[model samples]
Target: MMISSWRRRRAARRAGKEPRRNENGEMELTIPRDFRCPISLDLMKDPVTLSTGITYDRESIEKWIEAGNFTCPLTNQVLRSLEPIPNHTIRKRIQDWCVENRSFGIERIPTPRVPVSSTEVLEILSKIDVAFKKEDGEGCRELVVKVKSLAKESERNKRCIVTNGAGSVLSEAFQAFSKASFDVNVAVLEEILSALTIMFPLDGEAKGFLGSVSAMHCLKWFLSSGDLSRRRNAVLVLKELGQEKMDELSEMEGAIEALFKLIKDPICPTATKASLTVIYYMITSTSTNEQLIAEFVNLGIVSLLLETLVDSERGLCEKALGVLDGICNSEEGRQMACNNALSMPVLVKKILRVSNLATELSLSILWKLCKNEKSEDGGVLVEALQVGAFQKLLLLLQLGCVDKTKEKVSELLKLLNLHRNKVECVDPMDFKDLKRSF
Candidate 1:
């Protein structure tokens, strides 16, 4: 019987099947009952690196010591720790394997979502609206958080609430709040502007229109707020609004003052542009010209307008010329404007370098000065004429599709003819030929 059993065992060993033990009297592979590590709840940190000279963190080492399984996860052999393996290295290897296998169709865990009901959406919108209407700042803040949450969940709904409810609601609320108290209104205005900026590119039609209306309302409110800082901010906002609204705003008293103030302020370029718009409106509106021109002089605004001709902004320089047109239409106003402008040589050079529109404006202004019976330096026109300004005017007349340009040139020609010997007269035909070509 013993011989038979020995023969069977030898036969099993010879069949290429292991006796499940190595020379060291240890199992070749020992699978742990639990695959998770106590500390990390992940696969064993640094598998005991027996031959690899790798080490692991204390928790991993302790786990291997307790499990009595010091084999590497990869090699599945008895580990020999030659040196400690860094936790980072172990993590890197695991992460790299995860990435590599992921491309091969590994199962991925999905991120959890927070569910929001339709009622919650409506309620949040309502709350935001109410907060905005009542000027309840704290309520508005709370609603903003809820709105942000909704936005994160659904961009469509996020845009709806922020744009329609939050954006417009906040703007109106701030306007009302500003009306109640200047300081509070200013604060609310600042906050509302900030909210609008944040909610830009609002999604739907309702939101888009609301944003436009809100922006316009904010601009109007700032202009009407009567606060200097608010007016300054209004100037900036109106500038951003572009020429369309600016043209509409020119009719308002607050807008007029705000624009004039901007022109007068040494620091803001916006004033130069705004002043030009105001001046344009004032000149074109025949009824408002006298009053507007008087206001310009009263406010000491003429000097600044003249000064802007030298400003780097070409648009502003042209606008200044337009303002000069209005100023020079009246006798006292005309003299005042010419004296103010010609006093600044740099301004004169700027005007000379300007476009044909600007040159025509300068010519009209010079013509006014030449015709002024009260001009302190009536000789300025003669001096201007000496520089061939009259010839330039006549040249401009050749290009005369502009009725105003032609009329001004005709009047200037008449003045030169009337003052023949006093001023050197140039033939109108010379300019007429130049005009044909120009």
Candidate 2:
């Protein structure tokens, strides 16, 4: 408590423009306006000034640009140059102030690393080429580490690395590793993949070059064998490189397996989301392919969707349900849905739990399951009755639903009651218009 209080007083002194008193009644020094970034209102680390004549921390301004903002954040003026030149003079001054205030207990910050230039990234790429040509994995690993460090430093550095030919160079290394039968040391492969993950925003051309059967082999190695961090990075980079190659994922080994594991037991939400996105694309693209649908069911992808629906947030649940809806169009998929005990209850529960998209998708899955085969024995409808799905569907109708949704609900209600007595709770008076619709 005492140390925190002392630090609080020191912080107040750092920013105390009017020299306010602390809890102990000690007056603090006032910070000058010049020491602060105009946007963040804090001490600038690697301050860079825009063409609009306002200085900001490099990160703040870079993010603003990356988010698609074309104007200056503070001035709102159209920026003549999105590129911000470094304000080295101000950084030096802040360093000097910190040194002079040693008695005030404010620590001095070290010089910030300079952001990389495209020319320098190109030079590194050239070195990577020479090292790889000579089969110098050690030299290649060193240069990769260097490139990853630069990319991690800032958005500017990332753009520099990708725009210049470094992204392709990294992909080529992975391709070579795959051709070598994964003989490269695990550490070397990791460094190569880590560098590729950092050098992101691979354009269409770059993605096209990297999207190959060999590249899929490299990604599969990482997904199946690499450590957790490398696995996540592999997924992220795969998400980028897979943009133009979504269809081929179904044929790729470890693609569905790794993605299913991530969705079922996620290392992180980001990986799960990436996995879902890739799966969603693959499923939507190949819903009619018997082999792929069989693959999904065989890999427990449908059961995983049920589990995902139980806890996923609105957007992710919507996606999971969308994939579920698509695959349920296949006979094997519907059989899998009926096989999993939770699939029925969970699919019914998703109605009105998340969103309108979720509701429609859930209804579609149920509709697929009820057609001729599964509903013939009245098993799925009985499962619905046990899970209170009967009540939920009527409540959905009572609360009023869209025409198509109401149509499906009425049809399912008829099917549910077909083999048994009229469900006592769902009053005919409540569904007068529903009666007319059927």
Candidate 3:
């Protein structure tokens, strides 16, 4: 009886001690230890029983596997598959755990609320348009801030709102800003311009809307205003809208005329750059008919552009090359471009150096010159050939072969070869001598 009593006491002691199980299966789990889930890096949410009869949070196990930390907590063996953990089972376990763990009161997280709806966004944009029309600087600012806030919530809706609203807002802003002679007015207008620039690039629809309306208004404002600083600012803004918008700029009766006048005004280099940029955009974006080319020729814009090209400013030269390319695209355009002595030398030099826009433009100009053989002046084609322009053309063809410009380069090469042959045939000895001189 004493030995039996001693055995019972020993069994009680063993039960009180922490148990560890081996292959023999003689152990007991008392207090469950907290397990970390690899996915959330938090305490395990859903305790699951695996096929191996091991219990774990399915999410935690899957996360561990996903993170490449696939070792089981108890066995220290890599998990073969996490796919066996049913999502619904894991969710139910998590729900039960959350319900039982009342130690921490459930705190609801407040989701961020989107303050603006589609209709509200449109309404706000309409207000901005009205504010701009009335020259209400304070109102415009308020609406702009509101619109921006709404845009942050729903980008697509905000873009739609702005696209429809740009024209009215731009026109009003220009009118109001132009009429104000005060510094305060200038400050307000600057803000409006700044706001427009920010809002216009939301997406394609927004850009198209601004392009069709705000661009024209901007051009008009610059033309009507004598304030050099304001004109300069307007030009800067127009240039920033990019070359694509230039095609959309409506050629109202006075727009191009005003630009020409600004170009003639030598006092403002800033305005000149702006005007050149505008002309460059026009040339690149639109088709130049005979009448329009004639108008540009008569205005002496070509000579002005040539002068700008020779100026120390690299940007101006780039713009002029773009313009020259436009002019040389047609038969009449080629004659107009080549008629001036200053035009040829500068164009030749630009071609030789491979200036920014020069290669494509030079190829274009050469093509036109070759097409209309009578249009070829004394030394224009020969000078181009002598200056190693053909070699440059060849190089462009080789490089552009891998890019979208390949087809253009190929056509240009064909045109250059034709012109090279003409020059060779006309004065073979002269061409050879010129080549040697170079």
Candidate 4:
């Protein structure tokens, strides 16, 4: 039996599944008695009991039902009822055991938050509507906190609320505040924005519904002036709602500045990511809009993005470079990027430092600048030479980059050597190092 168990664990590891371990750092491959699902022979994540009193993991039994099976897996006896009650007691026991055995590499399972019921959601919505109608600022703020809590409970609750018309309700409430002739409490409005944050993973109809509201203009207000958490969630909502209305957002005063503010000084990592995502979608959809590109340049997006690249997370760096790649296609964007003091080294460093996506974007930005030599500064070639870009490019060529990136590097190298005399900033030792390395 030990030999069979060892073989089972060996096969499991070879197949890329993690085998359980003991406190002694050896594989403790034996399955716990109660933790195992009879149908799947795996530890149960969400256990449930059948009408016949047989228990199985929810996913496995659900699959069994989906496959048209009506009998209990253990008993093979027909179940009088198809609905399986969640065996919360067994699930808690499993969690407790995991906590006790955590030294064996067991992760304690977090208790799943219960999904919000449609009845409760409706009650909250009814209160919000009543609050809005009465022009009750404090009441609206109080009720919004409840809505926010429900949405934050779980992904399931988020989807449930949005599906049950919570998106439209939240949006209309914001519109009501914005259009009110009396003094609208900014705190109340911020709460409304917070509620939207919870409902942000909205469906297309929810997105479109939110997009139609005049409240989007409030993003410029909250993202620029609200607390940190509000700013983060505001941009997140923009990523979804702004998609349908990029042009409107671009035209809206302070909206563009608010976005740049987050990108430049990012309230948090998620805020930075949302800001990049917003810019990426904005540029990709309007690639040919010279006016939009000009706006991006005037807003100092290129220089700001380069500065943002210094130590950003890989995903943010990838997206920052991606936006730079698109915007650099414009003359104004190229000029701004090449003019920035830190642009060259940051771009060069990101070439191989970040992921393949970041590398591709960095190379593409370089290609665009190199292609546009008519600018008085002679494109990115001048900046690249000033930054000792040859050293990195040579290493890239020797070490290897993607085929397209390699081609861009090769073309960039020739430009560097061709413009060598014009490069007042080139280090003589760099050439000696280049020659010796070659």
Best candidate, TM-score: 2
CA lDDT of every candidate: 0.54, 0.76, 0.56, 0.75
Lowest lDDT sum, 10 consecutive residues, model 2, at: 428-437
Task: Work out candidate 2's RMSD over C-alphas.
Answer: 7.3
Tell me the tens digit of each residue's lDDT in model 2 across 184-294: 555667788777776677766557646767767667667766478877877887778653566676677677787788887789878777777777677766633677778
Compose the digit string of candidate 1's lDDT tens values, residues 1-438.
999998887665553222347799765422121323444545453432335444343455544555666666435666565233344444555445444446444333222233344466577767766876776766666665655556666444454455344555544554455455544445555545444444544334323333354445556666556565566555444544343343345455565665566666633555456546645665556465676667667777667766656555677777777776777787657657656634324333443355767776676666676666443434555555544555555555555547766776787767654444555644444333232433
Query: Which of the two candidates, 2 or 3, achieves a greater lDDT against the reference?
Result: 2
Give per-residue CA lDDT, model 4, range 366-412, as digits (tens): 76777666656556677787777776677778876667778888988
Better of 2 and 3 by TM-score: 2
Top candidate on lDDT is 2
In model 1, how large is the Cα lDDT of residue 154?
Answer: 49
- TM-scores for every candidate against the unseen true structure: 0.49, 0.74, 0.47, 0.69
What is the lDDT, from 0 to 100, of the residue 219 in candidate 2? 72
Models ranked on lDDT: 2, 4, 3, 1
Weakest 10 consecutive residues, lDDT, candidate 3? 429-438
Q: Candidate 1's error at 252, in angstroms?
A: 9.5
